[model samples]
Target chain A: MREVAVVGVGMTLFGKHTETIRELGEEAVWAALQDAGMSPKDVQVAYAGNALGRISGQEMVSGQMVLREVGITGIPITRIEDACASASFAFRESWLAIASGLYDVAMAVGYEKMTGATTAQIMEALAGASDTELEADLGITFPGVFAMVARRHMYQYGTTREQIAYVSVKNHDNGALNPRSQYQKRFSIEEVLASRPIASPLNLLDCCPISDGCAAAVLVAKDLAPRYTRKPVWVAASGQASGFFEPGSDVTVLKPTIAASQSAYKQAGLGPEDIDLAEVHDCFTIAEVLHTEDLGFAPKGEGGPFIMDGNTAIGGRIPINTSGGLLSKGHPVGATGLAQIVEIVEQLRGQSGHRQVQGARAGLAMCLGGFMHSDAGVVAVHILKA
Target chain B: MPETESTENSRIINEKWFTETPQGKALAGSRCRKCGRTYFPRKRVCVQCFEDGRMEDVALSRMGRLYTFTVAEAGPPGFTLPYAFGYVDLPEGVRVFSPLGGDFARLEIGAEMEMAIGPIRQDDGVDVIGYIFKPV
Candidate 1:
């Protein structure tokens, strides 16, 4: 396969928005195009990711509808969805299109308009990401599953509840510095622990808020990279994996994340130590701990203490979620994956104002979609280098 | 026929997932004749060995050990708030997900748990009866 480069990336402020999906998509796409110093006509192929548009009333041809707002027409526009990992999968496809020599320039846009839906509607929609026949039908919510995982983690590893709450505190601290973050306020561990309970050991503060937003990126072939931008972030590797249902599998470890991140590390000819920073799927506070361990950033079962030790904080060893992550930045499911990519791109370019990891040469972005049989249904891992 | 009508009215959430054995009511599952692996809620094929047509119906053990659990303070429409649920590891090595139906304070990991049939949630004023686990 040929090499691909991320020439530009952009995202809308992650929070409740009155704007339609089309408007949000247009804002992100146009910003990305302008950042790439290219026009809409330059995009040869396009992929759009929107997870809940159908539930919000845009059922068919959402890609066509969104792209038309930016005057991007008459191209192969495909809509992709894998629950929360929708945008990362779309991004991987865009990179593949260029890497396969099929298209010189490709664009991926992910948008979700969730604020328009009611809370109950949103809960029902999000629950669909799990195994509907077994888990969802049994009235299991995402927080419930993660709470169980947290319990298991604590039982097996002796992880304290305060250690888990520290993740929320650290991410919120970082989010406070990010202009695009949904919640720009930082809270103490006491406040987080005292927040209203959503699940035992996991309060409302530990969970990511429902959000509406969009994120986009432009990719080009290696040969065409210089024409778009001087500081192109090369796509070192892109890895994707699906969950395997094993009844007795360990709940503390995410098998798909390990598989995907290992595949990415191998493809990039690098190890977890080489990663300067990461933007992982922190849909919940406990999730960040699990991802940290699964991605090899920390030893298995020690993710709780690892974060509590200030290892994951900005300016610490291997700063993580510098964009505030899904917890503080808000998780707009479909948009979350590419929104992660947008953060890594900016950090790599040394453009992130306060949350930037200095001299960051390499970064990893990981996103997970759904849960089933005690595992993530899908996971996507991408490595980027300056 | 009268029992069938009563069962229908009872609205046992999923009929295929349970069976009445001489021992008692047990969760109906599938055991792969080739690998000897068992799965709950049954499977058309052995996901592990990918062996098709070598599956046989098996009754799951009614008793298990509480593996992990949590108390969900909120949930979707039908579930009563602050309900408890978890996974139970059975002797057959299959971990089953079930709603816990016992004293909240008595629930603990590694404690003995037994499968019980009861109303899991409400659906349009109807109790959706399904399998649950109670601390023993």
Candidate 2:
């Protein structure tokens, strides 16, 4: 397989968007094209990732319509949906297209218009991310699921509420530094702990909000990258895996993340030690803790103390979620995956002003979608190097 | 059956996967005869052996140990807020998500729980019968 590199990445501010979903997709796509110093004509193929487009009263084939509005037409356009990992999977597909010598230039775009719907409507749509047949009917939501994991983590590892709250405090602090983040105001640990409880052991601050936004990235063959940009973040590996129905030893651990990260590490020929920073799927405070451990950054059951010890902060050993993660950046679902990749690209290029990890050479982006059985239904992990 | 009877009988949510017996109502799951693996809500074929196994209906164990749990102060539409729920690991080796019955603070991991079937909530003027795990 040939090598692939991300030439340009672009995204709207991670917050509520009043524009139509098509316009949101267009803006991000145009920004990515401009950043790559290319035009619509340059894109050989395209993939759009969207999860709840129907919630917007749009057609199922919404990707093509969204791209067509951006003057990007006549290409083999396809829509990709993996819940929150929609755009990340789209990025993986675009990367594969280039790496497989299919297309020299490709684009991946992910968008979600969540704010257009009512809060109850939005909640119902997000609930669809879980197994409706087995889970949602039981009044199970993401917060409920993550709360169970957090409770188990606390019970098994002696993790404290203060330790988990620290993840929110730290991420909000970083989010304050990011202009694109949703919640710019820094939050205190007390503030997070005192927030409205969504589920026991997890307050509203512990959860990522229902946001509306979009993200896009332009990828090209490694050889053709220099023509578009000098600072090309090479796609080292893309690993994706599905969860098993079989019950595992512990519900605290996300088995699919561990499985996917192992494949990513093996493909990249690198381990956690080699990673300078990462933008993991911190949909909840507990999620960050779990992903850090599953990604091999911290030892099993040590993720709580790892964040409390400032190991995941920007200046820490392996800075995770310098983009404020989904916690503060706001989780727009479909667009979150590409948004993480876009952050990694910015950090790799040394363009992220306040949240930049100093002298970062390589970074990892982990995105997960849906809950199946006892774990994430699907998880996609990508390792990128400068 | 008449249409009126059918509609009333459909009070049981996910009827095919649930059944009533003389002893008690239990969740209906499938056990693969080939590898003896049990799955909740039944399965058409055994995922373990990848061959057509004689899947038989097996009433899941009515009692299990609470694996993990949480009390949701907020819930989706039609669900009463401040509801407590969690995953229960049954002796059948399948973990099921069910509403927790009894006091919220009293819930703990490794606690014994028994299955209870009744109206989970009222939907469209009909009681939605569902499963839950109650502290023993």
Candidate 3:
């Protein structure tokens, strides 16, 4: 395969959206095309990632509808739905299209409208990602699912409630600097600990909010990169993996993440130590801790203390979730992975302003999708370099 | 007689999953004749050794240990809140996801549990008989 680079990236402020899903996609697509010094016509192929479009009343073939809204139709447009990692998969596919010489320029867009639906409606829609026949039948919500994982981690590694709370504190602090973050206010550890309980050991503060947003990226062949911009974030590696069904599998270890990260590191020829920063799928506070260990950023079971000591904060040794992650940036589900990519590209280009990691040359963005039975449905990892 | 009647009359969540045996009500799983590997909610073929895994129906161990649990303080509409949901590791080497009943405060990891079938929720005045794990 040939080399590919992310020429431009764009994302809307991750919060509630009053407009339709197609409108959201249009705005992000326009912004990305403009940033790339190209137009909608320049995009040869497109991929859209939307998880709950049907539940939002957006019918199937939503990709074609959204593309038509942007005045780009009749191209080979395919929709992807992989729970939370939907956009990451789209990005991977976009990278493949460009790397395989199939398309010189491709666009990947992820959008979701979560706030337009009622709380109960949104919960039920998200529940579709789980094993509806088994787990959801037990009335287990998302927080309930992660709480069990947290409980297991606590039982196995002596991880404390306060330790997990520290992750929220750190991410919220970073979110305070990020204008695009949903919650910009910083919360103290005491405040997080005292928040309303969603599940035992995990309060409302530990969970990412249901959000509505859109993110887009423009990928091009490596040789054509300089024509679009001065600095391009090269797509060094892309890896995706599926986990085994949860039954009889270990919960504490995110096996898909472990496998995907190994593949990404191998493809990139870089290890955890070489990463300057990272954007991880912190759907919950405990998730960040587990991912840190699974991605080889910390020793097995040492992720709890790693954050408690302020190691993951900005200016620390290998800062993580510098854009505040899904916890504060808000998890728009389908749009989350591409949003993480947008941040990494911005950080690498030194355009992140206050949230920037100084002199960052390489970054990793990881997204975990869906829960099947007990394990994750899918995981996608992307490594980017300047 | 009541248990057998409920299994026949009431709508159990995923009927193919649970079966009432002479011993008692247990998860209806399938064991591979070739590899001896077992799967809950019975599969048509073995995933591992694919040797025409024509699985034979077998009852899973009713007793198991609570691997982990959580008390959910919130839930979707039409569902009971503040319920106990968890994973139970049966002796058959398969873990099952179910809602737990009995003392929530006393629930501990690795605690012994046994299978129990009862009403999980009421839909339109009809009780939905479902599988659950209760403290042994």
lDDT of 3 at B76: 68
Candidate that would win on lDDT: 1
TM-score of chain B of each: 0.90, 0.87, 0.87
Q: Looking at model 2 chain A, report the run of 10 residues with the lowest lDDT sum.
A: A244-253
Misplaced by over 4 Å in model 2 are B1-10
Q: Candidate 3 lDDT, tens digit per residue, A125-184? A: 787888887877667778888899999999999999999999999999999899999999
- Writing each residue's lDDT as its tens digit, candidate 1 over A181-283 gives 9999999999999999987869999899999999999999998889999999999999999997777889898899999999999999999999999999999
Looking at model 3, what is the TM-score of chain A? 0.98
lDDT of each: 0.91, 0.88, 0.88
> What tens digits encode model 2's per-residue C-alpha lDDT throughout B1-136?
1211225633666778676666767889999888888888888888888657599889888999999999998877777778888899989788888888877777999999998776665576776777878988
TM-score of each: 0.97, 0.97, 0.97
Candidate 3 lDDT over residue span B38-133, tens digit each: 888888878788867478999999999999899888776656777788999988778888889888877889999988887776555556777888
lDDT of 2 by residue, A41-66 (tens): 99999998999976766748778888
* Chain A TM-score for each of the predictions: 0.99, 0.98, 0.98
True contacts kept of 3: 0.81
Ranking by DockQ: 3, 1, 2
Off by over 4 Å in 1: B1-10
Across all models, the iRMS values in order are 1.1, 1.2, 1.4
Worst 10 residues of 1 chain A by lDDT: A116-125
Error of 2 at B42 (Å): 2.1
